[model samples]
Target: MTTSTAACAFERKDWLDDYAALKTALEQRYANLAWFASPQGGVDLPALDKRTRRLLETAEDESMAKAALSAFVSGFHDGHFSTAGAVLQPKIAQPLALPKVDYSRLNATQACAALGYGPARGAAFSLPFESLPGTVLEADGLTRAFRSGVVAAPDGTRFGVVRIARFRQQDASPAACEQAWSERQAKGAMSEADVKPVKQAANAAWLRTLAAQLQHFREQKVAAVVVDVGNNPGGNDTGDWAVRLFTAHDVHSARMMMSAAPLAALYFDEQLDGLRQAQKEQDPTPEAQAMLEQSIAAFEARKAGIAARGCDLSWAWSEQRPWQPNGCSRLIDAGYASGQSSYLPPKAFGNLKIASSIYWAAEVDDLRGAWNGPVYVLTDGGTGSSAEMFSALMQDAAGARIVGRTSAGDGCGFMADAPPVVLPHSRLRYRVPNCVRLRADGNDEVAGVKPDLPVLPTEGENDRERAWRLLDTVAADLRARGAKP
Candidate 1:
């Protein structure tokens, strides 16, 4: 466990080196520089740097040095910002010597907290599924009936409800995959070769099971369907697949980019490589072509910014643009066409990572309109990450109505495969989300997607009543919409 770099005593020279290394890494890897530096975040990194640097300089021992470093990162007040681990060498990073620190708990930084970082607003989406009549499929287990069926509206109309609690492929996988996974986990370590196909098979099963549920809804001749993501804490790209299943047309997800760092360049290159492979297999549809163009421009911008400002994003330190009155910089949009694209580049939410072995590039092409009918989604503050993503996509892409309240404002957090960035002296490893998802409104999803048909608790309304009222409202609207040709 003790290499030369790791074993370095907290001598003044060693301490300073660690501080400098950590500073350099943050400059390069921390993605929030643009947003936090802008008027939006108002984080005066230059001033904070001066203050923290002085603290580090005065430190005669390790404890003082740690405090100085923690203060510098803490100054941003972002939960995403924190120390990672100790570095043994140039590229080698390991876990924390102390417990891994989650900066989110600090809550000092207005960067996220002020912008709805904590509990989201509005009523919970706990609908009365138990109250439905016997004619409808009684939801049994998570699998048996796929946790779906029909709900009878008070006025004698019928509607379908599909409750998707989470988006993890492993969770929703087939029974066979679950058995294989159970067996695999029993072993000390999981081998990649054996794990991936099991997941893919399960994902295919999950999708089929869901598709079948939707088909059942269609067979029942329901006026519309409500996709309930209440209390749904987001997960992987299953959101992308789920959105595709509900609507016949292509639905564009949010756009995102990382800060200009080594990983940023790598991220863009890997994406381009994926695109190249895509081109090899099939012709570039207009959406793929557009995604390519926008992506290339973003890639070049990060390169140019890095070339101009170095890793610290120094260009924004002293009012680079009139727009940056707060003394921070923001990544300029790469001129995407019409804010809508037919295809989403694979891993658009998550690009390259050091931790993974395989990457899937197949875009969800099921435009067969799985539900073709009017679709409405139910969400609450509990809905976050990919769940919030589903809410946005269903509303923006499929023309589905989002009812209840605003979603959890997670927007985008850590991307796939969080390989740590260890400091040379301290060896403290850390990571940050290298990407962001921009909603169609030109705002980041960090500002939670607003519901189209907003419903909140009237002062005395109980949780149960609130849920029923929302359903009643949806039913009334569907009845009105149904009356049309």
Candidate 2:
């Protein structure tokens, strides 16, 4: 009556082992674990173990194990915490058949009328659109699911409309970049030459796209521009170009902090090495050398302080606390005063304050004479990550009006590159964020960016139609106010 282990449908022992490994990895590596643990009812290690045991006991296969893991991760309610490597076969609902629109023979004005808009006295152009459920049309040698262009009111006021589907770079595709990364890894460690080209091309293309839009606005003498980012899942930080076009100086975007000293040290070392290599290739200017020297000195001081504390190399300063000389006093006082918990590091490690650094958008030289007109950005719950970051910058730095629903709160904090790990047993890949972004104002966290003019769709009105209506309304309002370009 004895059963062989290999013949069993599910192995409880194997599942338990994998679960233990995953728990350890999460505790040690997950950036948000400490912050979220207490809020989620104090971790409850033994209770978690018991729950996981029951889950494994009932899990019929690897798929069930993965489901259990996914459920466990979802309890954190963190958008960044996710499980990959699951072959999902979701049920597909039948799509509704809709009539397509034809605009091949129509001129710009006629096309605008056909697309449910009034006469277009100004130029109309095609916009690259995707994901939106609508009829697409070919215009000006471009495939456009939506039309975006300049419109001039009868009163001689002009407005520019630009619809952006995502924050992805213009020239580089995600699939191509991923493939290139894989190829580079197989060849060996990536060099500057291997990585720089794709990044440079993407940057150039993104800047070019923004520049083109700005040039068009200037040419049309538009008093304002509407940027549509509705239903954007977000992508790269290429939205910086738009920020630069409106901002005259450097703008402090966000603050970044690492959970571990090793991570920060690794980043600093990489930056230093890159700068030094550049210096070696050609003599750096006096100012550049001085900057490098200062950075080196700062890095050394931090390293010495860490060594003196006797703390593990992995220990990093908490971003929650200010980096004063006696910053650790409050932590120590709270722990000793309560006697319920201790914030102190191991005896081998001493107390040290870690400093949080600010990220800024540097002024762009090419954007010196760029558009300074009023800006309106459209957002929705689907706007997240870099899209949220862009919206924050547009609102905080460029004085752009956000006109739509509140954005997705994915960029509440910052995340650094913590690559995914594959489980040995079920081969499930877990992606963990490395660093937590802390802002002094705490505005970008959780609540997301608020819209200046929150627009909601009415009955029988779709999101697209509502957005267009809002854009026109805002333009008219600006026109009424005698806003000038």
Which of the numbered candidates is closest to the native, going by highest lDDT? 1
Candidate 1 lands at a TM-score of 0.63
Best by TM-score: 1
Residues 1-485, candidate 1: write the lDDT tens digits.
35565435557777678767765655565556666555555467667777877887788667788888778777765544555554446543775577533433332222123222222222122565645453265454344424566776667666687777677654443353555455545554444444455456556666766777787778878878888887777877667557877866656555654454455555555545644544443444564455555655554665556434333465544432233212333232222211223354444433222101112213333323567788888887877877877788788778888988888766665553457777666677676655556666655555576787777879987776676677778888877766321
| Angstrom error at residue 259, model 1 | 1.8
lDDT of each: 0.59, 0.50
User: At residue 284, what lDDT does model 2 achieve?
Assistant: 48
lDDT of 2: 0.50
Measured on C-alpha atoms, candidate 1 has an lDDT of: 0.59
For residues 291-354, what per-residue lDDT tens digits would candidate 2 score against the true structure? 4455456545543453232222112211222232112211110001001111112111111111
Candidate 2's C-alpha runs over 4 A off are 1-8, 12-20, 34-64, 75-77, 86-148, 151-158, 170-202, 261-264, 278-286, 299-363, 412-418, 443-447, 457-459, 472-484
